[model samples]
Target: MAELANCPKCNALFMRGPATVCKDCVKREEEEFQTVYAFVRQRQNRTATVEDIVRGTGVEEHKIREFVRSKRLHPAQFPSLSYGCEKCGADIREGRLCSNCTEEIQNGIQQQDQLNDIQERNKKKDLGNATYYSMKRDKR
Candidate 1:
């Protein structure tokens, strides 16, 4: 069930698969990854930051960040490698949002749940009261 899609990198039409970009882009990315990896694997470059890697390997910062995000580059091996949190722009090694943002989101969801519960209870109470008044009127 392969579908035709434009390559994100080159805007050329190709069959979509597990890889987001077309075959040519994927090959280019692989070469870039190899270059970056080779540079990082050097003894003196183990602690290199993403900027340093980009400068040394001539690869784009976003490409290296993408590698880190995809787990192709492990943060444990490269301590200076990190990405900004989507919510707070805090430095993080894994996931989209930082812990603080995640906790805040959880608390917001809890508050919304409580509010929904209160509204549901109020609606049920109103329905019960209406039914009681209708029954009383019928009895009279």
Candidate 2:
């Protein structure tokens, strides 16, 4: 069921559905998309960067980035287009993180797993020692 909520863009109360924004905001965004699309569809502007598109169409940089993120703008069509990595703010064409950050995170996880394994082995050894001592005490 749809719930009454304020639109993130305009803060106007409306029934929340698949679209997060209200109808007015949605309409405005569609207009912006058309303006940006038209500007980029031109032959000379086909290879333009996000900055160029923003400058030409007067659209916000974030809005253009959102389009790229949503796959509305194909990176292959515009080689210069990229989005900032969530971790390091480096430019990346796809995924959440750059390759360097991804490798670092994977290395950290591997180190953590090694430490956990060592701890588990130590815990089992300690438990064995405690059991042996308890058995000896009971025998005495």
What lDDT does the true structure give each of the candidates? 0.92, 0.89
- Using Cα atoms with residue i matched to residue i, what is each candidate's TM-score against the true structure? 0.83, 0.88
Show the colliding residue pairs in model 2: none
lDDT (10s digit) by residue, model 1, range 22-112: 9999899999999999999999999999989988999999889889989999999999999888898888999999999999999999999
Stretches off by above 4 angstroms in model 1 are 131-140
Candidate 2 residue spans exceeding 4 A from truth: 131-140
lDDT assessment of candidate 2: 0.89
Query: Clashing residue pairs, candidate 1?
Result: none
Kindly give the stretch of ten consecutive residues in candidate 1 with the minimal lDDT sum. Answer: 131-140
Tell me the tens digit of each residue's lDDT in model 2 across 96-135. Answer: 8999999999999999999999999999999888843334
